[model samples]
Target: MRQNPERRTALLDAAIEVLAREGSRGLTLRAVDKEADVPIGTSSNYFASRDTLLTQAGARVYERLLPDEATVAQQMSSAVGTEGFVYLMREAMTRISGFRTGYLALLELRLEATRRPELREVLTKRVRADMDENVERHLASGLPGDAVSVRLLQLTLSWLILEQLTLPDIMTDEERDELVTEAVLRLSAPSKRE
Candidate 1:
């Protein structure tokens, strides 16, 4: 069967929606086919296997989170010498929150990737790239080399955001903002070399 780009995109989009609405555990070929309005055999023809489809869907989610290089450069240029970094970070976090299912699905994929060497390598590379981009952005803001600290800060902030989503009313916007501020300050602190 010849690959149809439009149909493929539709299937992937449907996969994301299904995953988001139902979590990773709810994802199934038939569900995706129905969501995409495509025939069941169509998904199998394109994806070949459940793992392949899920992995591709996960990769698509990651790609969606990252700002294009042009957009990042533009934002960085305009953000110089201002609190724009905080704004940008908040916006990024907000986007992540919007794709909560994608985040949860990623968590599931991470575990699955552990035993699948090929998937593991792919996930590792993608994660490393994200971390490197984040570290580079932080460093460019004049923060010292503290990659580990920055990673910890990111993890903490992500946890808080995810928790807020899972337990709405557990945290107010003011509380989340305060936590973000504290984490950013800690991560942006100058290193001992300074």
Candidate 2:
């Protein structure tokens, strides 16, 4: 079947809106069709199955959660000292806060993948690719061969930010910054294993 980018975009946007407003349980073809103002049949035509539609929608949400390479690199580069790191951390936390539902959906998808090996493999591949690219960029900035450490740092920081964003009342900004700073220091410290 010939693809329609505009229609696809519309469907994806509608899916996000539905997922955000209604959560996973509320996702339905009729709801998405109404959200997109497209016919129910059109949604089914574009996405043959609920799994297909949810997976694609979840991917879109994941992409939206992470900043682009250039943006991340620039942030990392400009964030020289501890203060700068805090600024970058705060910015990242803020961005994640803006996409709370998307992040939640991503977490759900990741959990779902555990039961579905094929889905898990696909997500793992994408995550590894993203981590590899980020690791390369971080290494190119004159850091030591700390790809593993850097990847761990990225994952830890991302989860921290997601946690803070999802449950703002649980941690104050100052407390969060202190935690992040401590994590960065420990992760970047000289390692006996290395």
**Candidate 2 lDDT, 14-105, residue by residue in tens:** 88788767776677777888999986678887887777777777678767878987988788787665466456656866787778767776
Worst 10 residues of 1 by lDDT: 80-89
Each model's backbone clash number: 0, 0
Whole-model lDDT, model 2: 0.73
lDDT, candidates in the order shown: 0.74, 0.73
lDDT of 1 by residue, 33-137 (tens): 988997767788788777788788878878776778898877767664325656666766777877776676676677668777766877888888888878778
Winning model by TM-score: 1
